[model samples]
Target: MPRVGLFITCVNDALFPETPKAVVTILERLGYDVDFPAAQTCCGQMHANSGYKKDAAKLARNFEAVFDPYDAIVTPSGSCAAMARDQCPHLTGSTIGRRVYELSEFLLDVAGVEDVGARFPHTVTYHPTCHGTRALGLGDKPIRLLRAVAGIELIDLPAAEQCCGFGGTFALKNSEVSSAMLADKCRHATDTGAEYLAAADNSCLTHIGGGISRLGRTPGAAKAPRPVHYAEILASTA
Candidate 1:
């Protein structure tokens, strides 16, 4: 058995901790030894995306030093994994970069199993995050896995490939534009009448959930679905 290290990105570690916890639950059930390196830090995604190359490189080097020993590195985030796998080596200028697998691809490709014996009884509409769709090109790995889960009704999200407008610092730099984009994303999500809007990335979830929460308070607005990470649903049984 290869020793797997769980890279719980900063956003997940701080705001949405359950996603990583659920990642652990699923991997353990799949018979993998999951280790949390206490020395792990940010993958410099936010810094690099925000145009801080030097700072991002520093973090990338630190990440390499900390996680170099693991045979496989798994993360519940697509953007962060994209950073470590695709961008980190270039940022650090070394062959020291280890392949970082996002949750869905790790399960479908590496683990080679779509059904993790999970059972999620809910109408879930999946939102493919920008990085997961374009950068990582996750394709239907997430959907295929979700479809195999017992008792899960997966709905096709309208304009599913559209961005949720949470591009890390992009939201902070362009607040008004981000809000408008988020409005469209939220409207489409609620239109599905699904109980949950699931995605691999929680940064988008945080943005979408906040938008839905605000919109739900609109006069005569219908009930809105909750934002959930797909890993949480996958970790669910019965």
Candidate 2:
């Protein structure tokens, strides 16, 4: 068992702490020794992605210092993982950059295992975010794991590769355009009649989940698919 550190990104740490918790549960079940470095800060992704190169560089240096000691750095957010693997090397070096991995990529490629003995009896439709889809190129890894879950009914999301309109600050900078894109993704998710809509990135889940509930409100809106992190689903046994 290699020493592993969990990089609970700013969004997951602040808004969706349960995501990191679930990551711990799944890894522990697989006999992994997971560490959460207290000194760990945001991977400077928010700063870099928002065009603050100086700030991003500073935080990127800190990221290498805190995580370099570990054998592996795993994160639930594909976007955050991308920042570490794709951006940090230019700021720092290849030291820690080569060690970072998006959750599913680590599970399927590094760990060399697909089924984690998870069981969840619910219909689920997955939305692959831009980073996991384009940056990470995590095609079908998430879907492969979902299919292996004991009782999961995984359905295909229409326009599955389309963006969920939450590109971190992109949502804030282009609210109207973001909302329009979200509407299409949510419509496709709801049309599947799945109980929950899941994604590798919680930020995307937050956006599309909100749209499912808030789009086209009337006196009484119909039931919409719930938004949940696929990791949480993968961590389940019932």
Candidate 3:
């Protein structure tokens, strides 16, 4: 078995720790040696996207140094994976970027394993994040994995390729536009009548999920769709 390093993104580390736990559960079941490098820190995605190139470069170097020894570096966040794969090479000039993969990419493309032996009895609508869809081109991998789960009703999310408006600093800089985009995404998610709204990136889920909660509080509003990470669902059991 190859040695794999789990690059738990800073967002998941601080806000959604369960995402990394689920990643480990599924990877271990697939028969891979997973290691967490304690020295690992933020992939500098926020800094990079916010135009702090110098700081981003420093963090990118730190990321390369920590995971360079591993045979493969896997992360559950597509945004972080995009940063490593797309931005790190330009910053650090290291080939380690090529070895980094998002969770779904690692499981489907690297491990060559599809059925993760999970079961979730609920209607699900998957939202494809911009970094995952445009940057990483992670088309259908997450959905295919969800479909393989027992007792899951995978519904199509309208405008599935549209941005959830949680583009890191984009949300902070353009709050109005971001809010509008998030509202549209939340509407689509609720329209699907799915109990859960799934996505590969928690950052996007955080934005959409917040909108869902706000909508639920409105008078005569429909039940909000709960945001769920793909890794968590894949780690579930019947």
Candidate 4:
């Protein structure tokens, strides 16, 4: 078994801690040794997206320095994995970027295990975040894993390839456009009649979930689909 380091991104560490916990649970069950490097910090995605390239470069270098020793660095966030894989090389001029793997990619490609023995009896729909779909090219890796789960009804998300409009700082700087995109994404998610909406990146989930909640509270609005991180659903049983 390879020594895998879990790179829990800033948002997951601070806001969605359970997502990483789920990654650990599922990986451990698959018989890999997973380690969380306490020295790990932000991937500097926010800084880079917010036009602080120098600061983002510094943090990217910091990320490489911290996780370079591990056999493989696995992260639950596709956006962070995309950053390390796509941007870290330009920042550090190092090939450590190649070692980073997003959660589903690691399981399906690296670990080579699919039926992870998880069972979640819910009608779930998956949202492929922009980074996961376009940047990482994680096509159907998440869907494949979700399909193998014993009791999950994984439904197709309309416009599954569209952005959730939570491009790190993109949401805050372009609130009107971001909200419009998010509303459209939420409508598709709810249209699936899925009890839960799953995606690899919690940042996107946070944005779409907020919209779902708002819609739920609106007058004459139907129940909105609840957003859940894919890892959380994979970590569940029964």
Candidate 5:
């Protein structure tokens, strides 16, 4: 019965709108009252990563203004969730950061339910984004949720902890090195023979997905991996 604000991270809004819809639908099914303010936009992770702390601080204030009324805030992207959970507090001692919860973390802790009643008859592998793993310490929360899905065979991705090389603006700054890093991660995913490559961040998925599609076009290169955001998968059942 928690009142929650859904931070439909920028990328999810601009590119992957379905992700946030899935997030809202799932939260509703869990009996939580979720509100999505149309005024919400980018969490400023992109600006912060690019050394634009001032811009990020402004974005944080905007977030605080839009979301402070809720008991807690939840987001679909691990990167955005980590920013709210880990970075927003530094901008100001605003209560928003203290109350912010990533979707996986919220589902496992706040909602106190491991099984979200999702169903997917596909063999999938999970790739834990670095922020979800190291920053937020959301170990196995996603796995716990996905396992409860009715028909999914979730395989453990090889080197699942490795970065997909989409560290916000990391790919733009070092395209070659980023491409190399993603190639390795893609190879590991393909090696597992998983039909879908799942992760919590669409930004990372976009980057890795780009490499996957490019590789699919190349001779002898691996086929493209379908990147499924954790929220999108969860929404599938809702």
Candidate 6:
């Protein structure tokens, strides 16, 4: 085996540490020596999206410095990984941009591990982030991985390609539209009666999670709704 570095996004680090931990577990079981590089921060996605290319370049340098030694860099979030794989190339003329690899792409294209040996006995609906779909062009890789789960019932979301509107700053900048988009997503998730609304990006899940919480507290709901990351589910060996 090869050694890989887990580039846990800043938001996941601050608000959802479990996501990265789950990623680490999954990669370890797959036989890669996973390492975490301290001093890493946001991929500067917020800055890049905000049109601050200079700031993004600075963060890209940080990423290159921290991850250059590893054979591969894996991240549970598609958006951040896309930043490295897709967006970073635009910010610089350096070779760092060419070496970036998203987790889904790495697992499917590099490791050749289709069956992750994970098991989950719950109904699930996956929300594919825009970057994951458009930027990384990850079609069904997440679904393929989910289906390998021993007891999982992966339900198809009617408009799985739709955006969750949690485009980092998109939520704060356009709360009304973001709320509407999330409401639609939440309804579809509820329609599936899935115990979990799963996705690669926690940012989208966090947005949908808030709506799910509100819907859960409303009258006559059967139970609380919880959003789960795809990595967390896949990392499960139980």
Best by TM-score: 3
Candidate 4 TM-score over all chains jointly = 0.97
Which portions of model 3 show Cα errors greater than 4 Å?
none
| Better candidate by lDDT, 4 or 6 | 4
Give the Cα error of residue 181 in candidate 4, in Å: 0.8
The ten-residue window of minimal lDDT in model 2 covers: 215-224
- Per-candidate TM-scores read 0.97, 0.96, 0.98, 0.97, 0.95, 0.95
Write down the lDDT of every candidate, Cα atoms only: 0.91, 0.88, 0.91, 0.89, 0.83, 0.83
Which sections of candidate 5 miss by over 4 Å?
Answer: 220-222
Position 93, candidate 2: lDDT: 67
lDDT of 2: 0.88
TM-score, predicted candidate 1 vs. hidden true structure: 0.97
Better of 4 and 5 by TM-score: 4
Per candidate, the number of residue pairs that clash is 0, 0, 0, 0, 0, 0
Question: Residue-wise lDDT of candidate 1 within 35-98, one digit each (tens)?
Answer: 9999998888888988899999999999998888888889989899889878887898756445
* lDDT tens readout by residue for model 5, 71-170: 8888887778778867778775565777788888888888898887788888889999988888888889988888888888888888889888878788
On lDDT, the candidate that comes out on top is 3
Candidate 6 residue-wise lDDT, 1-238, digit = tens: 6668889998799999999999888888887888898978878888999999999989887887888887778888888877887777788644654556666677788888878999888888888889889988899898888988899998888688888778788889999998888888888888887788888898888888888889988899756347999999988877
Better candidate by TM-score, 1 or 2: 1
Q: Which regions of candidate 6 deviate over 4 angstroms?
A: 222-224
- Lowest-lDDT window of 10 residues in candidate 1? 92-101
* lDDT for 216 (candidate 4): 90
List candidate 2 stretches off by more than 4 Å: none
